[model samples]
Structures are given as C-alpha cells and as structure tokens.
Target: MAFGIMMLFVAILCAIAVIREVKERNFLAVGFAGISFLVFGWFSVMTIFVSGAPEM
Candidate 1:
C-alpha cells in the first residue's frame, strides 16, 4: 500500500513533467515523461487494487 502511494505520487509528477515538456516542445522529454506516467500510473493503480488502501 505504501509502495502504491509512492508510485502514485511519482506518476503524478511524471504527468506534470509531460505537460511541461509538451508546452516546451521537447518531444523526447515528453515521450519519456508520458511513458513514465502511463507505466507508473498503471502499476500504482493495480498495486493498490490488489493490496488495498492503507488505513487512514
């Protein structure tokens, strides 16, 4: 659960980076960040679904 949360955070950061890179017209960076966002987002969601969320 903790790992999932951490990955979720990382995915959010990558998403922000993707947007910024797109605005700057850095195709390479955009590609990297976009892929990172997709991979990390998927992993995080799946992990959370499998393991369940942490207690508040």
Candidate 2:
C-alpha cells in the first residue's frame, strides 16, 4: 500500500510534467513525460489489484 502510494505520487508528478510540457509546446518533453506517466500509472494500478495480504 505504501509503495503504491509513493508510485502514485510519482505518477502524478509525471502527469503534471506532461501537462506543462504540452502547454509549452515541447513535443519531445511531452512524449517522455507521457511515457513516464503510463509506466508509473500501470505499476500503481497493478499494485492495487495484487496486494501482499493473504486471502481467507
């Protein structure tokens, strides 16, 4: 849970960066930030579905 939260924070940061890059009209930077957002966002989602807790 904690790790996922951290990854989520990073993902948020990347999303913000992507937004800023887009506003600045930086194609290369936007592409890099967009990729970063996708990777981190996927990791966060996977972490949420597959946790360390055991089933009953």
Candidate 3:
C-alpha cells in the first residue's frame, strides 16, 4: 500500500520532469522521465496484485 503511494508520487514527479524536459529540450531528462514512468507503472501494478500480508 505504501509502496503504491510512493510510486504514484514518483510518477507525478516524473511527469513533471518530462514536461520540464520538453520545455528545455533536454534529451537526458526526457529519457529519465520515460524510465521513471515505466518503473512507477510497474510498481503500481505490483502493488495492486501482490498481497500485503501472508495468506492464511
């Protein structure tokens, strides 16, 4: 649960960075934003499907 929230925040930050990079025309920052978005998305999916507690 916490991880998902963290990832969501990260995704928002990355999205902002991506927009900034586009405005500044920085390829590196754009690439980083893309990677961050991918990672954030993966974590979001994991958080949704993975159980938070041990199965009983």
Maximum-lDDT candidate: 1
The candidate, 1 or 2, that scores higher on TM-score is: 1
Judging by TM-score against the true structure, name the best candidate: 1
- Residue 53 accuracy (lDDT) in model 2: 58
C-alpha root-mean-square deviation, each candidate: 3.4, 1.6, 2.7
lDDT at 2, model 3: 80
Q: How much does candidate 2 score in TM-score?
A: 0.88
Q: Which parts of model 3 are misplaced by more than 4 Å?
A: 52-56
Better of 2 and 3 by TM-score: 2
| Clash count in backbone of candidate 3 | 0
lDDT of 2 by residue, 1-56 (tens): 88988999999999999999999999999999999999999998789667845677
Among all windows of ten consecutive residues in candidate 2, which has the lowest summed lDDT?
Answer: 47-56
- lDDT against the true structure, per candidate, is 0.96, 0.91, 0.84
Report backbone clashes per prediction. Answer: 0, 0, 0
Give a tens-digit lDDT track for model 3, residues 1-56: 88787888888888898999999999998998989988897887688568465677
Report the error of model 2 at residue 48, Å: 1.8
At residue 6, candidate 1 shows an lDDT of: 100
Task: State the lDDT of candidate 1 residue by residue for 19-52, as single tens digits.
Answer: 9999999999999999999999999999999899
Candidate 1 ranges with C-alpha deviation above 4 Å? 53-56
